[model samples]
Target: RPGKEPEVDLPYYHPRAPSAEVEMTAYVLLAALKTEPAPSQEELSFSSLIAKWISSQQNPNGGFSSTQDTVVALQALSQYGAVTYAKSGAASKVTLRSGGEFQQDFQVDATNRLLLQRVPLPQVPGEYSTEVSGEGCVYLQTSLRYNVQPMQEDAPFTLHVSTIPETCADSKAHKVFDIGINVSYTGERNGSNMVIVDVKMLSGFIPLKSSVRKLERHPIIERTELSTNHVLVYLEK
Candidate 1:
């Protein structure tokens, strides 16, 4: 099969950091906003939320991952701001609350609107709420950072890697050995997206070019790449 785009089904904005997916999503939202019929309040609300989220991904240098993403994100954010801007001017306050345990306030005013202010989240694995009052367009965004360890109990996928020729019974085995890889998906879904396997060669060893070409021709593999210190195998789902 040929290469294709991935499908993101998670409940979060994205599974990883800012990338082309985020840029495309922002463009899609902008397209939705420009449709013939006016969007419902619910859709507008959702779009606003997405716009703020994209804004939060902005780099300190005032750009996204690339120039294209930066342009689209800025266009979407500007449009959202125009649509939701309040006529009256007043200082706005954002409140971050986690259940009944913690509460913090962030004030946004003309004096501090251009400045960047941030506070660390007090807890992890907690439900938090953001509310804004006396607003003239106060954007509040929460970022989530967490580690993803291998799933021990109910992993969606499993990988096994081994090398042939346990012993140097054959002289050539010392110089070149075939690598064996077995992967299985046991998740609820039919399968996963594309998987990339990076096999790093030993300091003095490298993959054989002919071997890489053979792997690249396999039906299950999309492409193969050989570098100075590693071999990359692209596998299809």
Candidate 2:
């Protein structure tokens, strides 16, 4: 077992071990220290010292970087509520402009709210626009559109109904019904009306009573006992 590359338990690696980037190393060490149970008073003091050291390296633009450092240090400090070089202290403010451009400023604040203002935009004339506000946190912004069309007075119609087996074994077969309504009007360029048709499926050869007196006159036809599996109905007018 001497040269057998000691079964290195990868997960228990040291918290203070150097990473490829100093910022990443500090972040990982801080995270580990935060999670470790019953850390000694000396360890706590060391963690505070490192936090201050990382805070000192904060960048003016809210992003930290060194020539040899792969990870940005200011961003890491922002996550831990530490003020790097940000005038506002703990929050990173990002400003976005048209054409997919953005700028970021970092600040450390004890209160979480980060107020950003004075964002300038290029003006476009004669275009109607409105902004909507909502309560709770503003996590995202998006645009939406809605359109409405006039209903048709005269249109063709179709109706269908059937019984099918339920997916679950313990349940009985269910009578599934679907009504397809299609209406088209020709004269004067009028919109189509939605015709609501009532459908009924009788189990046996006996005909079921229907509120609709006759299918043809009512702009609909009710077909019953067409087959053992299902029944079909449609608008006769």
The candidate maximizing TM-score is 1
TM agreement with the true structure for every prediction = 0.41, 0.22
lDDT of 2 by residue, 1-237 (tens): 123333534432322223244666566645635644545667656655665666444433333455444254444444344321234333333334343333433232335444533333333322323222322222222222234565666533333333333142433323332223334345444543343343333453322224223444543343323334343444333
> What TM-score does prediction 2 earn?
0.22
Model 2 regions more than 4 Å off: 1-21, 31-34, 38-41, 66-237
Clashing residue pairs in candidate 1, if any? none
CA RMSD for every model? 11.0, 20.6
Mark the 10 consecutive residues where model 2 has the least summed lDDT: 135-144
Q: Candidate 2, residue 199: CA error in Å?
A: 80
Q: Give the TM-score of candidate 1.
A: 0.41
Residue-level error in angstroms, candidate 1, position 28: 8.7
